[model samples]
Target: MRLVIAKCSVDYVGRLKAHLPLAVRLLVLKADGSVLVHSDGGSYKPLNWMSPPANMRTLSPDDVDLETGVVEQWIVQSAKTDDRLIINIYEHISDSSHDLGVDPGLIKDGVEADLQRLLAAQIDLLGDGYTLIRREYFTAIGPVDILARDAKGATVAIELKRRGDIDGVEQLTRYLELLNRDPLLAPVRGIFAAQQIKPQARVLATDRGIECKTLDYDAMRGVDDSETRLF
Candidate 1:
């Protein structure tokens, strides 16, 4: 990862035009070729970001840019779309690179892991007569959070997330794509199970023919007297 603190202005042009005025901000260039511009606030979400499969070029400031006190410019262009991001740097406060090495990815915390376990034990939460095949069912890409047989006896791949978002739907779609290729699981279906699912994610999941079920975390954990809700 490369991190740069710079007094820069950003302009994004593509489907929309947006601008971030000159200010000191953190710029992150990830190994995947993604770029994110972040302010000190807004928690972990970046103020602006360009997703991967993009190219970036550094160039000297033009005459017009120099007159505006711009010292350098970085042009990042999307590879798959018309999106483009331009960073106009007035001054670089700091630049550093870190060798993060291989990442182990996210470690499931107690609640998430426990939720998986409880759901695995109570496979019927997915549907009536659903029987668990396994938890952490191995796949070539990664483990499916839970594998089960639906009431109809079809293989069902379940992906559990603490908070379901579009990315979670994407992940489950990939798993279904791979799993359905196997002769044994050829007709595999997908279920995106989560505590709270974003409205946008629900739309995407439904469009993909994957069912979205919102789990009651407290009820699933047996801590709350309220009935576990599934939809």
Candidate 2:
């Protein structure tokens, strides 16, 4: 990763126009060729960012840009789309690079992981006669949160999220696409389960023919309590 703190201005041109006036900000260049411009505040969301499958190049300031006290510029262009982000650096404050090798990715924790475990044990939450095959079912892309079979014995891929958003739907869609390719799981269907699902996510999931299930964490735990053994 490369981190640059400088006095700069940013402009984005693509599906829409956005501009960040001259100010000091942090420019993050990731190993995946993505770029993010961040201010001091505002949680983790960057002020502006270009997703991966993009390119970044540093160019010397042109005469016109030099007149404005610009010393250098970085052009970030999307490889899959026409999106572009241009950063004009007037004064460089600091720049550094770190050799942070391959990331292990995020670690699931808290209520989310616990919810998965509970749901796996109580697969009937999905529907009558639903039986869980496994949790964290492996896939070439990643692991499906839960794999199960419905009442009619149809393979079902369940993606559990704390908050169901469009991204979660996209994730389940990818898993279903891959799983359905296998003759063994050829007819796999998708169920997007979450504690709270956004309206947009529900619409997207419905449009994609994926079932949207709102999970009741407390109620599920209550059901588990009733089924617990004292032995």
lDDT of each: 0.90, 0.91
Query: Candidate 2 residues 1-231, lDDT tens each?
Result: 999999999999999999999999999998988899999999999999999999888788553445468899888999998999989999999999999998899985436798899899999988899998999999999999999999999999999999999999999999999999999987999999999999999999999999999887867777545345573
> What's the TM-score of every candidate structure?
0.52, 0.51
**Tens-digit lDDT string for candidate 1 (187-228):** 998999998899999999999999999888767677776744
Looking at model 1, report the run of 10 residues with the lowest lDDT sum: 59-68
- CA displacement after TM-score superposition, residue 83 of candidate 1 (Å): 38
lDDT of 1 at 226: 74
> What is every candidate's alpha-carbon RMSD to the true fold?
9.7, 9.7
Looking at model 2, report the run of 10 residues with the lowest lDDT sum: 222-231
Off by over 4 Å in 1: 1-110, 227-231
Q: Which candidate has the top score in TM-score?
A: 1
